[model samples]
Target: MEQLKLAARNARKKTIVPVKQVRIGEGFVVIAGPCSVESEEQMLITARMVKEAGADMLRGGAFKPRTSPYAFQGLGLEGLKILEKAGRETGLPVVTEVVDPRDVTWVCEFADVLQIGTRNMQNFALLKEVGKANKPVLLKRGMYSSLKEWLYSIEYILNAGNPHVILCERGIRTFETYTRNTLDISAVPAMKELTHLPIIVDPSHATGRVSMIESMSLAAVSAGADGLLVEVHFKPEIALSDKDQQLNPRQFKQMMWKLRKLVQFHQQLAKQKSPRGET
Candidate 1:
């Protein structure tokens, strides 16, 4: 808790990282795209699909950090170029993961928001590296780290110079193997009490199943998540990475429809409860 000087919970919320016009901490934001940038056509198609469905921003991993060394290690610079192109074409800001400290400076040229994946959540070197960057950051919770640990890691970025830091709860490692990882829904509200930073959820990574993403996403919203980090692909079956969990275009569109209604309801409810929202 002592390590969380800047990121610690306070009476006043700290900051909302701006990704173009999209505000990360102020209201609900949806960031959707393929887990890995597969190709120009794939990224473009998926980007337009999500944009038409009303996503706030786009996410496509340029440098993926996989558990297996033999797996597809992402397209690197090529993927980043494609991601940036899609973002430009669709008028949506881009967010991508940067694994190596050496790549941070150059990667910022392409990405609007820098992402710290679950594995690198506590990599102090990487944390400090991104912290030095001028861009906003999306820091996912470590697979096995506690809330305190996650906040502590975020402090690295803020302490280094960047104040626009967002928290993403992609789930946690637990004994049960039914899901890819256990989605901690409570963390959504807990983070509200633990830090001034906004928290979003990654249902795609949490439950490595297409069947559960919509429900988990709605649950996250209900639990008070500021936004979502979803994996959407034009063709999930043929995706280069995380295919099983990535939402196909049809599913994503349908999910977006439901999410919009839910978001509207939440907004109305909050307005009614707030003194300033009094009619």
Candidate 2:
């Protein structure tokens, strides 16, 4: 934990990670998009939808690390191109997963934020590579790693000289099989206490059910999460991956409506608690 001093929250101020024009940690930020970039049309439509829904950033997987090799692996570089173009059109910065250390440079060229997925949380080489990249990194906590281990993995990235790291708690594996993964809401505040880096929640992957995402998203914000990473597709029924967990554009817009109110309320409470004249 001492290694994370640079990322440790000080009573004086909070760490605000800047990705392009979006300033995470300043308020409740939302990053929403499809789980994978299936096509040019899919990417653009979803990107525009999320942008309209009030997402601060767009997320899609270009190099997916699927449990089943037969599953829809991402569109590789083609997907990155589509995501970049969509981001340009929608005026939202793009965040995409980079599964290979070798592709970090290539991925950095197109991605405004490089994501180190839960599977690669402990991949030291990949962490180092992303840490060296010029883009901000979204580091997901490993599904099976302990809180300490997760912080240590983050240390790997910070140790490599990247100060722009965002911690994403996408949930962790537990005995309960009812949900795909257990949403560790406590991690939101726990991480805030442990590190100053902006911590976001991924409700889509956490609950693995669209029905729970809205509730969990609200809960996360109330619990002090800095932002949210959601899966929003234009057509979830036909989404190439994680269809059950992806919210359609209408659902996403509704959720955002509720979320915006919650965020405003949360900010108000925060302001009330802070010293007078402090932002």
Candidate 3:
């Protein structure tokens, strides 16, 4: 019996260690911004609007990976500089995706979090490079990868001496014509059970339709997502990339209002269910 108790205590310690000490959303963190940093003016305007809408962090792509070589490849360092300026002005942490291992240092210098995009989830060298940096990282699940593969990709970061990691569910590729990608909602609950890391859902990328973002985002919260990462643009139709997934200012504000109500309700319910005689 004593031996069994000792084993159980050790297991508990391991679980407890991983659960705490990670920088994450306190309630429901909202990360929002444009799909790409078109110019200084565009990034600044969107940053201010998202901050006004109660977003916790801002997201923009400094280096875009396009399927076609002729497509726009983002503004690179200039965009990061613009993002840094916006972060300074708005007091919100900035998150930007890095596509190359060589740019890790420069990217980490400005952005609060380095996003490992879906296409680069399996980029072991790049993952190792970011892992060595002092900044936090957001790892997005690959469109065709399994949940196990996704979590193990996180292991690459944690093992490289950084514990500040976040998991993003950005949907997976499927044959459905109705949506851009099929959302794996069950992954939220499953991840909660398997890991202590915070999980944020990207309904924007999952559905690829602004009209569907609100519904999918609400559903993610219902399934216990820790936060949301959405694309917010002042103008969507003329945006450089992924215009279909971007939300205008008015729509984002509405979603934030509804999310606030849901968060409050959940907090109250949690309070009411406290264990007997517990604080």
What are the per-model numbers of colliding residue pairs? Answer: 0, 1, 0
Clashing pairs in 3: none
TM-score of each: 0.96, 0.95, 0.90
**Candidate 2 least-lDDT 10 residues:** 3-12
- Which predicted model would earn the best TM-score? 1
lDDT of 2 at 62: 89
Over the stretch 115-142, how does candidate 1's per-residue lDDT look in tens digits?
Answer: 9999999899999999999899999999
Q: For model 2, how does the per-residue alpha-carbon lDDT over 1-279 read when each residue is reduced to its tens digit?
A: 556555556552667899889999888889999999999999999998888888999999989999999999999999999999998999899999999989999998998999999999999999999889899899999999898888888878888889888999998999999999999999989988878789999999999999999999999989989899999999999988999999999999999999999988876886676777885
Segments in model 3 whose C-alpha atoms lie over 4 Å from true places:
1-25, 274-279
The segments of candidate 1 whose C-alpha lies over 4 angstroms from its true place after superposition are 273-279
Once superposed on the true structure, which residue ranges of model 2 sit more than 4 Å away at CA? 3-13, 273-279
